[model samples]
Target: MTASTDLLATFVARYPAQPATAFWRGIEIEQLARAFASDGVGLDLGCGDGILTDILFKRIGVTPRLIGVDIDPLETEAAAAYSFYDRIHTIPAQAIPEPDASIDYVISNSVLEHIPDLEGVIAEVGRLLKPGGRFYFTVPAPGFHRNLRGSILPGVSRERYLADLDKRLAHFHYLSAADWRAMSARHGLALDSATGYLDGKETRRWEHLSRMTGGLLHSLSFGKSRPIEIQRALRIRDLQNRMALPAPVASGIAKMIACPDAPDSDDIQSCLLVTGHRPRD
Candidate 1:
């Protein structure tokens, strides 16, 4: 393999499996299985690493003809071992490599945040799903928690971070539950459900610490001091993350912080679970 390809392969090989990643994999698989009956063809958009694809195959046992699509060739290469995908398509988020109305179910998880043209992607997802087919996905909710470093520094002055945040959030456009509902309506889809995933307070605490440390490191030039320093920082981050609270507990704390004013029934902040359906003729 070429040097660049070999480097990517090594990175993929060393990528550790984390609890949070496993939780989302389970969520996506369960959502897809619940949405479709046996023998249904499904499309996994932005199927990075194919973890969710494998989960769907093992849990559902339907052997649903699966098509995995991603923009990253390296991720697709790493996903080759899953063997659940009947085919893999490398395509941009705004355009899918599938015939119109060809898929019975469409699923995306934590992928929408990275796409610049979300509306175009939504339109493409709509075009790809057959009538009555469902789309299940998640997106970060709009709040301080949705800010670039919101999960890293809760106590920093908003003004201090706003400029830096603007640059980061530029790559991500989080929507409120209402915003998603309206977006779905505009695209001839009905919002079936919306649920939050983090408490507000917890999100703020995580963001506060993360941002403070990150800012200090940036200002001290630690991030660029040397290749060794960069590697050291990465190691520390991995250790800190591993030592963090369990997913359920972290999620609970995030909801409390993010939804302080929220009603009892709606108390999540960071992630939102959304399901929608295309209108039938």
Candidate 2:
């Protein structure tokens, strides 16, 4: 994958069930691939379904000794189907079943924001990492809700819409770059870098695509109280996933939805990539 088009196509093929998510992940997955190594023992914190890790490792062309963990049994069960993770555990983020300083690295993709007790998880990461081991995570910036493109309909409240959307997405935290740095330091991890991605334009595009693809189901399922079950029971997810397209066709669709603006300005970003490392001392 030389350009964004190739990365987007990969996600489009794997995540046929959620084209919007694919569009979003297309950018995130690429950013993530460049931020880490392809070897060593890594723990996928909150590894939902394992598609992201699988695609990420494929992009890197190396499969490390990877372990996946999730609080939800259903998600862990689904993640077990993928060969990316050597082991899958259904456990709380605060309580991973691993020895202290045993892991070489820890990665959590878009999972930290949904966690209410983020401090506990970060502390766990510090404890689990072999000193000098890194912790890589992605979360929405404070601008996430502000960057959204809500309904243009008359009498539509953007605040109301965004709040509802956040609830539906189960987002609990929208931390600033500085906030992440401070949190990392508190957990004995030095903040290495914090970069922004998913600009305002692309965030808006994602919102549009999500509404077009999963709006009805979200409404019917009462803000996705049981989105997986609903999608499975209706066979909507199965049908969507089954329609994976060839690379060329997927690329074409991705190009159409691709956002041209780059996330150069930090203030306008909808998401952030934060990396920190434990001190070797």
**Alpha-carbon RMSD to native, per candidate:** 9.6, 2.5
Q: Once model 1 is optimally superposed onto the true structure by TM-score, how far is the C-alpha of residue 139 displaced, in angstroms? A: 1.0
Candidate with the greatest TM-score versus the true structure: 2
lDDT of 2 by residue, 1-281 (tens): 11378888888877766788888888887888898863588999989877778788888778667889899886677778777678988988998889999999998999999899999999999999998898889889888887887876688798888877877778899998899989988988999888888887788788988887665567777775544566678776556544567888888887877776664354578888898899999
Best by lDDT: 2
Estimated TM-score per prediction? Answer: 0.64, 0.91
In model 1, the worst 10-residue window by lDDT is 1-10
